[model samples]
Target chain A: MTALAIGIIIGCCALGAGIAMIAGIGPGIGEGYAVGKACEAIGRQPEAKGAVTSTMIMGCAIAETTGIYALVIAILLIFVAPGRFVDILTKAVRQIP
Target chain B: MQNSIQSRNPDRTTAKKPNKFVDFLLVLMMILPFAGCIALKVLFGNPGKGINVTGAQIYFTVKMPLQDMYITEGTAVSAAVVIALFALVLLLTRGLRRDPDTKRQLVAEFIVEKCDAFVEDNMGRGFLGFSPFVAAVMALSAFSSLSSLLGLYPPTSDISIVAGWAVVSFSLITFYKLRGGAWNYFRGFFEPIPLFAPMNVISELSTPVSMAFRHYGNVLSGYVVSTLVAAGLSSVSAALLRMLPGAIASFPLLRIGIPAVLSIYFDVFSGIMQAFIFAVLTILNVKNGFPEEEYERRMRKKQARRLEREGKKRPEREKNAA
Candidate 1:
């Protein structure tokens, strides 16, 4: 029974990690769109390449915030959640039986 | 490695080798750790427990004997902070000359000039006082994050340290906003409708949360990945050498070159980039917190000064219209 509970906890954490990483798509699309516009602007004004690149980098970093948050959540689920989950599960199981 | 090899070859051809004893001592110091580990393993029975590497393994935790308290990431961070402060003081205390004669003086001047320009660019010249704080944050973050490369746990990897920095920046933002005007700063939250106030408050709160998490997550992730890679490599090599007798099976030959290449990106590039982003975000948030009217007044004053410098008289008609 303990083994089954542990398996369930690990499986749920793996699923949560996968779901969390789905947030990566938003940043991927947003950053790609931003870079595309930046490229167009640079093409239009070659002399302003430095300004365009700096703005693009700043914008890209801000856009990456969501993706970074998702990554943090995923990392936590993978590395930290299982230990806490086991502790909680064991306590609950002891009370139930 | 190439530079060391070249220097060694030249020294061997020379009649007099300088600091040969010191060089031997350095090599011995480097080897002492592996030698000790081997000696401990030989003395004790092998439990056959493979290296149990995990995120927690990267951190060095020291527990106090009498209390439940423990010191972890603060150790590395405080050491980095002290070293940075000492270096800064040492650099500044060297006699100030019109012309910087030594390399250290030149580097110090370069850093000061660059930090001044960065602060001015982001927060405007009126907020030049913030340059020192910004410079310190950037220096501390970069140095602490990069310290992980030296096998010390980086302080930025600790969420609490990053959160402390973020909260300090948030407090500065709030202080500036209150200085601008308390009534309007509070009223700004309820703008458009009362329903949006909670949303505004949440957005305001998330600024620090996001800032803290971003730095912590990046550093910690890099540390975890590199550690896992090292552990994986060692385990793979160990498994391959299992056929060999006893001690030879445990040798980790594959753990050298590959991780160094990964560290260049994870440790060096990410460390510098995260430090820069943290400073830039701090400047942006602080500058954004100032009242719009004050900002406009400063802009107008600057424009008037610029026009005056060009030998143009202020138009009486425009002043009357204002």
Candidate 2:
């Protein structure tokens, strides 16, 4: 059962990492949308392409932020959560008490 | 009209199929290097796992064209060389484009536009004064994040990187204060409260530190997590093979696909987001300058609108003249 629990934790972590990439889908769609808008604006007003492209890039950058947050969470789950480490620490503290 | 664009092509004398071979080669080029490394890790052993460099275990590794080098400390040749090369390349590239030629101006314009929008959204119209800082922050973050996607450690995840930006940001604030009016700026620090000045000052002084830590915490956490997962999975696969050879031989197929997806998120998605957040936070911090002044200016415009509405009869005179 202890082994099962460990397996489950690892499996969940693997799933979390994959799910985190799904967050990137938003930015992917958003960046594509931004580019499409920039292209359309450039076609309509060629002179404004500079302004349009810049705005698009900025918006895309912001939209990309959410995906980053997801990535960070995914990474934390895998590497630095201090999960088992913390558990060990707590057990040590409890033993002392 | 958009759907008919291909049909309306003037040079449609012969319909041509896209060269699938070239397209496949491009895809292969992007994947082959990383795929080869992973394959080698599974087949033999990835020497990168907790590499012992000069008697110390280091968390970082670098891949050259043929060999992989692990660096356990800041002094290690592998990490130091790569970082130095990256910095030198960056500096040389910047130096090459230092002159205000036609191409530079176009790049500058794009940078200006991004800066303007960032400031306007976060700090409103008063963003013009700190435009240079905004441009610098955005450019740095973008380059760092883009490099992370290309399979290099994002410098943004480094504590020193955050500290460097924080120092620059704090310096800009001081400079802006001096330029805007030294007396008001210095006194403004104590204007809202006099008795708790020391605590306020300390808090204000620590703002940059806090900013740096916030960014470092988020990015460092992600970097550590991804590395652990990758290592942990590799070990688990190895152990399972030793324990029950038959049942877990099929496990490799299950493991690779799942973790590859995770790597894309950890390495690409999170890296880019953290970079943007760091830049945005910097821009937001610099933007506090214009709020008080811009609010007053906007208030005056509102008052003028009210007066114009009260004097609504003036439009009739203009209409009669026309």
Candidate 3:
């Protein structure tokens, strides 16, 4: 029973970590695309360099929002960890049943 | 090198992209710890299990044998060693002599020149005074962000660091206003609103706390989650994969692949974004000091100007004069 509880707790943490990282996919693709477009715009009108650069920066910043969300989740798991509680709970339940 | 700069055009392909090696190195710094964490998980057990709590397996250990000090996981000593090493490297790099004629040096020169151009084009030469502040804060945040991702103790994740940065920014604005005029700085705060002065003051005091907490909270969260995930998954896989024969033992990717994906999100994506957000917020706070006052002033001035153009004054102004 203790073994089963431990396994489940471990599995949840693994799954949670994976879920947190999934947030990165959006920004990775978005930032790359933004850089490409910004470069293209700069190529078209060098005179609009200021506008292009600022817009690009602003867009990239916005793209980072998801990453921040993921980071928050990751931090929560490490610092205020509750996985052990699950392990303990399951173990007690198993003992009773 | 000079020729490269001279011929360099933003529109032209002749302009070289920034060194990919540097980018790779920066990214590597963030992942190194995760790699270590995984290795430790397989060799030992999960270190983060009792990381911060009492009565838990002390994640860190130190032993002195034969007049030599040895340290183990979860010690501040580990962080100190890394910081000391980084500082040493920085010092060495600082002492290196660069040939102005070399391509690499030219690249550095080009970046500085581009930065100057950007500042001048947007905020003018007067803003150069603030350029160092901007560059320093951004660079530090970037480095800190990367370090966080790598599973290194990010100094920026500490409240002390965040508060320190906020204080620096706040002091700079205060000094600028002092030089500009006491009334100007005092007036600057009240420019946007005179009625809600108390609320403004409270927020002004709270900015440092919020700034620090925001950065620490975000980065710390990422570190914790990644650590848990790594610990849990590796233990499961270690047990499961052990049951398999030698053929399957060779390829642990079945277990590791999933954790790697999580690391990517927490380390790569969250790390960089949080750093950028911290830097951006720092810049914004500095730039938009007393925005409410500024807004109110503009509104009042516009009203007065409109009344003047119409050959009639606002009732408030008329009443004041009367």
Candidate 4:
């Protein structure tokens, strides 16, 4: 029974990690749009290629912050949160009257 | 060495042989560690049995008696930081050359000049005072992140270290803002409407948190992913080798090539990119806190006063402007 409970906790955490990774979609679309525009701008003025590329990279990196945050949360859930969570659950169950 | 060899091997076939030999040596160097590990596993019998998957292997922790506090990877990281700083100081102070004749002097001059130009371009000329601090932070961040390549846990992977850096940057930002005018700085928080003050305050507070997390998250994620990939590779190799005879069954032969490719991206590219971005953001934030035009105007006033003190006649245009 304890093994099943621990497995369920980890399974749920894995599900949460999968959910968290969905945030990557936003950055993917946003960066794609920005890169497309940047390419068009660079083509219009070849002399501005360096500036356009650097700006695009900077903008994309900033836009990637949300995705990175989600990744950090997912990592925490998968690697760090599970053990502490199981400990808490076990302690609470033991304290029941 | 290569030039001398090339000169001796003027024939096309001879030159091609040397090139091939060098390529072979490079490949051998790359694969040497994996080969050694496999050999050890075969001789020692299933070394992977001793591998610990959890906190035991990944983290190095020491307990402090005073508060029972756990000091983790910070111990290794702080030692690396101290060594790096000592080297930096030695490099800067040891050479007193009027003209850079040696390679070391040339490299030192290039670094100093580039750092100065980077600071001046971003923060303006009069604010070059901040260049040393910016250079130190950039060096620290870059070296700390790249330290992972040496198999040491990177300092930036710890959130607290990045937070400390962010706090220093935030304090500098606040100091510069206050220098502009304390009353204006306070009033600016409630600008355009009083209702927006709380939002303003929250945004101001979040600056340091975001900065800290941006770097810490990037480095830590890279470190975690690489470790996971390595473990996964080792397990896959172990399983595949199980099909062999008992002596070689436990050897993890396949754990060689893939992790090296991943490390190039995670350790090298991301580490350098994050360091550059951190420095860029620091310069931009500090530059924003103080107005360049105001600084330039003050400098002009000071120059005018100096000229007057010397009893030098101000130019006609300068007199009219003053």
TM-score comparison, 1 vs 4, better candidate: 4
What tens-digit string does per-residue lDDT give for candidate 3 at B247-284? 66534454456766876776666656655565556555
Q: Which ten residues in a row have the lowest lDDT in candidate 4 chain B?
A: B52-61
Q: For residue B201, what is the lDDT in candidate 3? A: 80
User: Which candidate would rank higher by TM-score, 2 or 3?
Assistant: 3
TM-score of each: 0.77, 0.45, 0.50, 0.78
* Per-residue lDDT of model 2, residues B1-322, tens digit only: 1223334444444444445575455455544544443343344444544521112234467888887765432223223333433443333223122223435335545655676766677776655556655655655554554444443455556656668778887876666455545565667667667877787789778767766665655555555665556567766776667666676663543356556576576656655565566666566655664345645545655666776889753455444643
lDDT tens readout by residue for model 4, A1-96: 877999999999999999999998999999999999999998899999988998898788778788888988998899888999999889988898
Candidate 3 lDDT score at position B105: 54
lDDT of 4 by residue, B260-316 (tens): 788888888888878878888887888787755565666678899999999998788
Mark the regions of model 1 whose C-alpha exceeds 4 Å error after superposition: B1-69, B292-322
What is the lDDT, from 0 to 100, of the residue B84 in candidate 4?
50
Comparing chain B with the reference, what is the TM-score for each candidate?
0.72, 0.53, 0.55, 0.72
lDDT (Cα) of model 3:
0.58
* Number of the top TM-score candidate: 4
Kindly provide the TM-score obtained by chain B of candidate 3 when compared with the true chain B: 0.55
lDDT of each: 0.77, 0.57, 0.58, 0.74
Full candidate order by DockQ, most accurate first:
1, 4, 3, 2
lDDT of 2 by residue, A7-81 (tens): 776777768878876887887888888889889889999988777876676566656556666765666666544
Model 4 DockQ reads: 0.45
